[model samples]
Target: MKNDRRPAGHVVAIASGGLDSTTLAYWLKADGAAQLTLLGVDYGQRHSVELSYLEATAKTLDATYIRLDLSGAAALLAGSALTDARVPVPPGHYTDVSMRATVVANRNPLLLDLAVAHAVSTGADAVAFGAHAGDHTIYPDCRPVFVEAYRRMITVANEGFIAAGFQVLAPFIAMTKAEIVRLGTLLDVPFANTWSCYQGGRRHCGRCGTCTERKEAFALAKVFDPTGYETDGG
Candidate 1:
């Protein structure tokens, strides 16, 4: 059993309380890689409910979870569905390009930038995210290209004091949400503790794009979704 204490020099995971990130945390932990510091960004998104789950997930994994709220900055993006109630969260399976607006622009850059800083300051060797291929078409920042760029930047940017610089890892960059869910199951991640609804409802709206994808992922993985949700008979 892994202890909760932050390791002297460990790997840091970017945990958004979404399936992918939570799964990453569990996978790394299962591998007995090292102690992990779970990083969650509260960017003024409507689905703040997910933050609660982030806390629970971290606690369950015996990992340290820290929050960096960028809500004040994210609040400026009024048209994004994650921030604006009027945007009307889109429903059903949508491609990444079609779902682009939902992305908080510069979100990945800012989050990873801070994560890098955290890694350097704390002597962590790497920073990881839950970005998958499905996100690439819509969220360029989630793509491998961007990840590699950041990795290079982090290395060249911090070449002196910390010779053991940081690296950005995205293990699922080519997998789909369903594939991620499947992998998560293998890692023994507590799926119920992860939240993916874009709507800030008590239960998942089940109609939003995120909920739909999440439902489909579990379905594809041939696993039952244990989360609470209000679904319409479709």
Candidate 2:
């Protein structure tokens, strides 16, 4: 199938050091992104360990890695479980109602804004993010409508610059986490080096929504997960 919207040339990827984003980075490179830059945001989330994995993934991919410190944003967007210590990170499946606490208000937009600015400054043709179908239920920003609307907004916001070929890409927007896992496997992504738990512990807290999702994705993909969790969610 010919993709009319195929991405090419310089690309900036918003990476969170998780399975989806890490996979997205590798996929972009394999799909012929001439130059790739991985952008990680430090918004004072509990799982700062993900930043470490972000750097490692960039090294593995031989892409430039940049970290933007948005810790101040955490204070402003404080009610979410990820940034607020008072609100606990919930356990169990991602579909659970309690998992909504993990949503950081306007996170995708804020991150995408930063990424787009970086892309514009650096002469990038596209900006990519790893948001997937699994995130739609919990994160409003991860849905297809939001992505398309944001793309249109960016296009209009850029005006004449749109002719320069600035595109907002979310390749996995319609894909499930398991599908991403399968694709990542095909791309030989180093899943062991990735991090996804909401808790910033030494090891993954398998009970957390992300960790559980990760485990489930690998299982569903029939891939052997190398992640070492503090406890077995199974």
Report the number of clashing residue pairs per model: 0, 0
What's the distance in Å from true for residue 231, model 2?
A: 0.9
Off by over 4 Å in 1: 1-9, 163-165, 232-234
Q: What is the C-alpha local distance difference test score of each model?
A: 0.79, 0.88
- Which one wins on TM-score? 2
The pairs that clash in candidate 2 are none
Off by over 4 Å in 2: 1-4, 232-234
Tell me the lDDT of candidate 2: 0.88
Among all windows of 10 consecutive residues in model 2, the one with the lowest summed lDDT is 1-10
Which 10-residue span in candidate 1 carries the lowest summed lDDT?
1-10
